[model samples]
Target: MSEILRKGDIGQAVADLQADLRRAGYAVERTAIYDNGTRDAVAALQGATGLVVDGAYGPKSRAALANFDVSRLMRESDLIAAADRLGVPLASIKAVNEVESRGRGFLADGRPVILYERHVFWKQLVAHGVDPAAYAERTAILSRQRGGYAGGAAEYVRLASAMQIHAAAAQEAASWGAFQVMGYHWKALGFADIESFVATQYRSEGDQLATFTAFVLADTTLHRALKARKWAQFARLYNGPAYAENLYDTKLARAYARFAGEESEAVA
Candidate 1:
C-alpha cells in the first residue's frame, strides 16, 4: 500500500513516479509538476494493467506499477494497420501522432486528454435550452484560465465541473484523445454518437489511432495532404490558421523525416 500520487500533488515522489511511468513506456514529462501529461500517463498505465484507471497512483495503482512491464504497451503493428487502412504513409501517421500527442492519450485521472472549451460548452448548453445564467459564473472562471503549449490540468478540472452541469453537451464541447479530435465530429468520423466516440477514446491508443485514421480519411483534403507529404497543407487543415503559431508544419516535417529515415535504414 503505497501513498497516492495524484494531479496537483507535486513533489520529488511525483517526479519519481513519473520516471517509473516513463520507464513503463508511458509518455510523461519528468517535470515533477503532476500536470496533464502525468495524469494521462497514469490513466494509460492503469488501463494497461487492469487497475482502476483513475489516474491516481494509489495503493493498488502503485502495486500494479511495481510489477509493470513496459514492453506490453507496444503498438507498431496497429500504427502500420492504421496507415494502410487510410492509404497514407506510415511516416505521415507517425508524424501526426508525434505532433498531436507525442503518443500519449489518457490523462492521470483515467479520462481522455481534453481541452474543454468553456465558450463552446456555454453555446451548447444554450442550444440545448439550458439557462446560460446557471453556468455563467463558472464558465466565466474557466474562460479566464489559459492553456500553455501542451495544455494544462485546469482544462480537465473545468471539464469535470462543466460535465456536472450538462454531461452530454460538455462531452461534445471538448476535444478528445491523442489526435485531439473534437467530439462534435463523431458522426462525420463514422462514430454512431458522441458517447460511442468517447468510449473508443478510452479503449486504447490503438483505438485512438483508428479514430485519427477515420478522421483523416473522411477529409479528402487532409488525406491528400498527407499522401503528398505536404506538411503545411496538412497542418493548416488539421490545426487551423493558428498552426503557424505552434510551427505544427515544421514539427510534422521533422517527425516525418525521422520516421522516414528509420524506414529507409531498416530497408538498407
Candidate 2:
C-alpha cells in the first residue's frame, strides 16, 4: 500500500521534487503547488514500477527521485547560452554536466571551494592565504589555461560558494540563484568584462549559471595536466601530493578518464 511519508509541510517537499523533475526535463509546473497532474505523475511512476499507485508523496517515492534524469530538465537554449557566458567550450560543458549530475538536477553537495589540509600548504604558497587574493591568483592561472576568462567577480562568487574546496562558505550563497553566484558578482562581471556576440550580458542569471558550470569544469585541472603529463604538477594543481594520491588513487589519468567517461554521456 502507498503511504504518505509525512503531512502538513509536504508542500515544500513536493515542490522540490517537482522542480527536480522539471529540471530533469520532465513536465512539472513551477507553481510550487502540487495538484492532480503532479499526483498522477507520482501515481503513474508508482504504477510503472509496480508500487502501490496511491497519489501521495512517501518514502518509496522519495527513493525513486534518484531515477529521474536531469538532462531533460534544462533547456538546450539555456545550456548554450550558459556555455557562451562562461567562455568554456560547449563540448567540455556538456561533458562535465553529464558526468557530474547526469543532467538530473542542481548539484547535491554544494560547498565552499577549499584546499584540503595538505593542499592548504601549497595554497598558502600559491594563493598567499588571502581569501580573495588567493582566489584571484587561482583565477589568473585558470584563465591562462582556459584561454580566456569571462565571468569576472561573479565567477569567483560561484567558485567560492559551491565548489567543494570552499564547502565552509556555501551557506553565504543562500541568496544566490541557480548557479549560486551572488547577484553583486553577477553585476560586476558585466562592466568589468567586454562581452562579444556569443557572450551573454554578465548580470544575466542565465549567464551566472553557465559561468558556475565553467568553473566546475575547469577546477579539475585534469585537462591541463593531461596535456603536460606531469604527475606532480597535476597533483599540485588539484590539491597536493597526498590529497591527490588519495583522491585519484590509481593515477591522475585513470581518474580523469573515469570522469571524462561520465562527462561524455551527460545530457544538456
Candidate 3:
C-alpha cells in the first residue's frame, strides 16, 4: 500500500491493479506486470476522475478505483465492424490503429486526441478569407512552415487561439481522434461538415474507427494498398511522402505482423 506502481513495477500489487482496472472496463490486460497498457488505463482513469494523470498507480489512484464505473471506452464489436466495413482483416485495422494512435483514441483527460498543424492552419486561414501573412508570425498556431507542436492536451491551446482567428478553419486545420484524420476531410469522409466530424470525434473510439474506415474506403489507392498489405504504398498515401524516412511503412509491416500472427516480408 505504501509503494507507487509505475510502468515497470511488477508483482501481486501490479496484478491487482490490472484486475481493478479491467473491472472498471478499461482496455487493460491482467498481465501481472505494469506495462504501457496498464499505465495508459491508469492515466485514463486518473483523467476521468480529475486526478493528476501521471500513469502511475499511487494512493489517490487507488482511492479513485473504489467509486469507478464500468463505462468502457470501446468494444470488441466495434473493431470487428470496422474491419468488416473495410472488407479487411481485423489485424489490418488494428495495425493501423496501433501505429497511428498507439491504441488510444482519447488522451489522459478524456478528450479525443488531436494535433494542431501549423501549415494546415496557414492554409485554413486563407480558405476562411483571412490574411495568412498577418498571422504567419503566429507560427505556433498559424504558419506556412510545419514545425510547432505542443502535443497531447496542450495542443488544444494552439487550437483555441487559432479558433479565435477563424473557428471553422481552425478546427479543419487539426487532426483528430485515434485514426488522426484531419478535419478537412470531413465532407469526403462522409461527415456533413467539419462540426459534424468533430462531434463524432468526441463521441467514442468506435466512431473514430468509423472515420478511419471511411477514409480508407474513400481512396481507392489507400484501400488497395492496405488490403494488399503493401505497407510502403499505404504509408505514403496515409502518412505522406516522408513516411519511409520515419520508417512508417516498416513499422506498419511489423505492427501488422504482431496483430495478424504472420511474419512480415519487410521484417523477415
Best by lDDT: 3
TM-score of 3: 0.72
Q: Give the whole-model CA lDDT for all candidates, comma-separated.
A: 0.74, 0.42, 0.80
lDDT at residue 22 of model 2 (Cα atoms)? 74
Quick one: best TM-score, which candidate? 3
Q: Candidate 1's error at 237, in angstroms?
A: 1.3
- Report the lDDT tens digits of candidate 3 across residue range 29-81: 88988998898798788778765344667655776788853233444467678
Tens-digit lDDT string for candidate 2 (1-268): 2234322234566677678667755676755566756765665665555443344566545556666432223344565565575554454344333322222222233222211122222233333233544444554222212222224334444444334434323322222333333322323334232222113322333343454554434555644543444445644644445755454323544534544553464432
lDDT of 2 at 158: 41
Over 70-152, each residue of candidate 1 has an lDDT whose tens digit, in order, gives 22231556677888997877887777766866345666666677777766776677767987676556643234343322365
* Candidate 2: stretches off by over 4 Å: 1-72, 83-89, 101-188, 191-208, 213-268
Worst ten in a row by lDDT for model 1: 141-150
**Where in model 1 is the C-alpha error above 4 Å?**
1-74, 131-134, 140-154
Considering lDDT, which of the candidate structures 1 and 3 is the better prediction for this target?
3
Instruction: Give the better candidate number (2 or 3) by lDDT.
Output: 3
TM-score for all models, in order of appearance: 0.68, 0.26, 0.72
